[model samples]
Target: MFGVEARALMLEGVNELADAVQVTMGPKGRNVVIELSYGTPKITKDGVTVARSMAFENRVKNVGAALVKQVANATNAVAGDGTTLATVLARSIFAEGTKSVAAGMNAMDLRRGMNMAVDTVVEYLKSKAKTISTPTEYAQVASISANGDAEVGDLVAKALEKVGKEGVITISEGKTLENELEVIDGLKLDRGYLLTNFITNTRTQKCELDDPLILVHEKKISEASKLKPLLQLVVKLQRPLFIVADDVVGEALTALVVNKVRAGLKVCVIKAPGFGSYRIDHLLDFVALTGSKLISESTSLKLEDVTVEMLGNAKKIIVTKDDTIILGAVGDKQVIQERRDEVTSQLKKATAKFDKEKLEQRLSRLSGGVAVIKVGGASDVEISEKKDRVVDALNSARAAAYEGIVPGGGVALLQASRELDKIKTTNFEEKVGVQIIQIAMKIPAYIIAANAGYEASMVVGKLLEKIENDSFGFDAAQGEYVDMFKAGIVDPVKVLRRAIQDAVSVSTLLTTTEAVVYPNYTSNSNSNLHYN
Candidate 1:
């Protein structure tokens, strides 16, 4: 399809998806009940989840829906809490852009204008953002993201208080009916076991080792011969062996797998974290944490000559497909503290922003512990939904901590739209494009008010009249206008910034698209048409 007809079909798709997703937008947004392929139906208020579950029978419409889904997914991946807002923005942009294009406006010029407007709004948001650091501020942001759930908000704040901003916080199902938070004296790595065959627990799909002897190798172990002596010693001692190396491949990996399958040898191998010199620094940190010596070419130590005393010991280690957690690492406190001080010194001297960030992360991992939030509910469906909220809350809190926050309830974007009028455009079409975005920016605040049973136009009009106070807006929950920040209503600046940028990126591409293609599957045909 080409021209107006194609764009019209795509707009139908955009509207269909936006309509379903926008309902779950604000504090009072309604939950969407999605039927699953198996088991009970899933109920959620998560915008990304709702967007992902949507599908249209019409292929062209599905393409439109998929494009909106991309915006939601990208927002979720980058900023975590603004997926719904991103969808709302995308729908509005494409809807308005489609009409402009149908009326003979240049799509490219319009896109350029939209981009310019988005850039201005993003800068405006950054300028108006207030940095938040206290636990109370963290809870406020979390609560709003969790759809006004105070308990989830408190839990997230407490987790961040315990784990620090850079530390890892993981969400899982609770064993009991009450939500619980656990702070572990452990370290988490992004790297996991190299192969699933090393897994010992089928239920969790993890490789679990108890009182494991950790081997920290700086170089690859390609030959099984170099590992023979260490393997023999571990087997004789009847202890599980956990290997962290640059890479474990070829004959060495094969031998380990064969021994694990046939001889019931408890062993697992994972590639060390980071790369190049960074990898060496991470290995040194790991070694210091575990009281293990590094088997490196820099040292006189060789793999075959390594003794049991040189190996690190841990109370327990859990290895999953994407990450690993080391619990109760057995290392000397003084040595760990020394390593911590060294990293601190290096961090203070670091000049580059990237180097400083990496150093900060290492310092956090060294001193800051890991936190686990166990979400609880009466049923599997309830637990799943609550877990999603918890995750969103956590992510929002982290983002707020990093880049500060702005007025919530869409007041930030609503006020930012006013700045678009000041943006000078080169042509009438470009000016129209800027006008389109200016109107689109108001939609979030409008839908948020409309969803709460208030007259959206009245709320938006009143807010615009009071635009001098950037933080002033309608508090739909209370049915009154108030300062959003004073009312504890806030959103991470990063979330809002990313949402606008991503929405414009995908929506403008969609607005300018003159063609779409899909497989024509007949009723009796076995051909599978998949749209990703």
Candidate 2:
């Protein structure tokens, strides 16, 4: 039967994981080189990746490691940052719980107390949050999370400013000119390439049509005779033609592809999106967007009915395997404006969450300008690290815009802990919980100070005393407490809250574990142990 030995095993494994991960918790944190099973070594400072690389032969140890990994992964997923903080917090909480349990404290009591503390701390954090307003503040938040890289932060801030709040930002790893970024007046379509053969540009694996004539038809075209007139007209214009149709089959589809292959005609066709009324609405939307008339069941479903007057124009159309994006749609300004107004009205009335999100996306497409950041590094390792940093910087910047920023460098957490001291708890569970959280809150700053080779207790104690109401705390790097925001040390409120929520969840769950079941012991293999 499982007893003290099992609990010890669990706690020991968890402690090891936490200690290794915590070493990489701060700005001055060290990197870890992990040797893969294939004998390739990779170095990184990312807590989630480091935690994931660790493996244990003992089941109980593995279980403990798994719990820590879950917290790291979940924290990163919610906030796109703060993996290291979450790992360190979870480890600290677990260590405290183990100590209390050893001193005859009930596991359930500890769990309840921690839960109450988490809620209280989170609420307090929200109250202390200051919404980021200036571009300098935005850059500060981005830079802190991007390993103090000011260039990355500046890039993200400028790019976001160009794209607006609702505009999309896409990141790709590639080589380009230094500090190069592009903003395109484009729309991200939901429809992709209809056929691989239709992809005109093999180099980019995209079907790029320049100033292509757009035709939106709802009916299938199965006969070459039906398209003969439209083909003749397109040939006469000597411009590429893009057909968005319900279906193009039989000789009509074959003839179009054959002619394009033989340089007889320039044409690419894709299936129109949606069905029934939805299909009709999308067609109508494009009608205003591209100034294209619909040749549907109502318009006499025949290519003979297709005329130059019905054709719309797009400055550039790129059809990829996943979707089609159009730029500079040339349509009647009045028609497009009217359609935009209608969508805006619909968006206001959209109640369901999904409907609201979809409407918002539609509105974004109507109002263009999407920014793409092409990030590059000299090596594979550098590129991978840069990509992660860029993403964290972007997300942190957006989070700052969406909510606000708070004092960083453990100052906020220390301040949040002080908040719990103001509340008087009658229940013993809540009181104990508050006490635990108060200690847990100091862990981050303490670890940060320790990582810098300074006395943790002295740094944290001074911070706890100095940061009473205002946002001020010890800067581990400077060895003194100062106003965090003024020092350009800030974090997203969302990221901090998310990290605490996930850390408490994992820590509380791990605290109540009474047993470590090693099932099917005989079948177990690969008994070698590993650590990071």
Candidate 3:
């Protein structure tokens, strides 16, 4: 009696916290910084983090707190996102299941039936997805869908081609880009190709440029000879040049900096140690030494450091009179002087606004395909959480970005709730798990529809109708909105339904069976909790 009541009471408390946290799971999630009355100050929207941080001795005996942390931790693990959905789903299932348990229903039987239901849902979601070819559509979906700074629309699309769907990684803190990635158009290769040199060996050794005219395997102006056609134009710029060879002839590089700084040319050094391998430590020291711009790149053929380091796989390292820039791969180095199908061509337009045909042409120039995904939401929280849901919906697809609420993670708990509500007991656990998933998936399904201004009930009816007819599609979120119907993409609701069913099949087995375990349970956990 006590455990039952305590579990129920904990469920209620979990719901309360979930309610507070679910709405703030993404980049646009709510910012909460609370100064507690008697504990450490706290802040964050991650459901799991916040839940774990909470610990106060209360009448509920920490049941509520324990549940909150479980849901939070679960949410973070599955999706790299989706904090709030975990909370809401866990609490909702417990809340509903406790009612039946209190009414004297068999807990094990209900748990089993619910698990069966969730299994059905998971299988359903898997059947709906199809593989893609080009990355253009993916890029568009992500760009158009992501919130804030509409200006990044073009940049996002172009980078997709360069990085590929899987490689087009974004570094962000809570949905906002930390590095402020902007496309650079000023340093155009115009020749249609900027050399590619791959460093497949060396790890953390210093790169030295040993010769003035004898170039290393890579194709940077620092190593390329004055005789090379690509660098003939540098003479036209009339910038003082210090090509680091055996040693400095005099203050040659400095003299150039003196004249060039006034003309917007600060300092230009090819390879202070000739134009070959130069030390990064040396580069940094020299930059600090001369207060002049220093460029760092590995002529070494090792991919470990270049590919491993965030900025290593670069092919072109430019230390000009004004700003110092590194282009292409860095630590993971690749050098190709010969132009290929369209690497140079694509690199030429990496900073430009994408024209569907133009981008298609440029990317097609390369043999491999590219993809991009963007998610949209009504507000910050909506956008952030929805992004995770979209990623989950498009699981295993290329890098994606979106905004909206998360679907729950500890789906097993919710599946249990389904059995309690089911009319049968044979595959009762399995059957009910399906229903709970169907209902929970409703979170994203209805919202996606509602955001498009659709009537949720009507869309749901249509989907159910489809299910009855054994039709291929589903009661998708966009289907409810009606506006997004033309898009061939399956709805998030359908995807989750499949996942829920599959999970229940496996998850229900975890439900513990006992004669009785609630003698000390509370009798008053849900008397007057507010929903809003």
- The RMSD of every model to the true structure, in order and in angstroms, is 7.1, 5.7, 14.2
How do the residues 295-338 of candidate 2 rate in per-residue lDDT, one tens digit apiece? 86686645687778889998998888887878888889888778
A best-first ranking of the candidates according to their lDDT comes to 1, 2, 3
- Residue-level error in angstroms, candidate 1, position 148: 0.7
Per-residue lDDT of candidate 1, residues 3-82 (tens digit): 78888998899898899999988888999999999989999999999999999998899888998899999898768789
- Tens-digit lDDT track of model 3 for 1-532: 2446555556556556665665443223454555557745555444455566566555463555564555455444433333445455555555555555666666676676555545544443344333334444443333222321233333454555555543323322233432133333112111111101111112522121111111121233322223233123333433222232233223433333433444433222333321233233233323222223332234333212222111112234344222333333222112122222234454456554333333333233222222334444445544554444344333212323221111112222223333334444465444543354446544533333343455746655555444322222222322322222223232233223323332233223222312222224345764554321
Off by over 4 Å in 1: 188-285, 296-300, 303-367, 521-532
Report, for every candidate in turn, its global Cα lDDT versus the true structure.
Answer: 0.90, 0.79, 0.37
What does the lDDT come to for candidate 2? 0.79
TM-score of each: 0.77, 0.80, 0.46
Error of 1 at 134 (Å): 0.7
Clash pairs of candidate 2?
A: 113-433
By lDDT, the best candidate is 1
- Can you give the lDDT of residue 90 in candidate 2? 83
Indicate whether candidate 1 or candidate 2 has the larger TM-score: 2
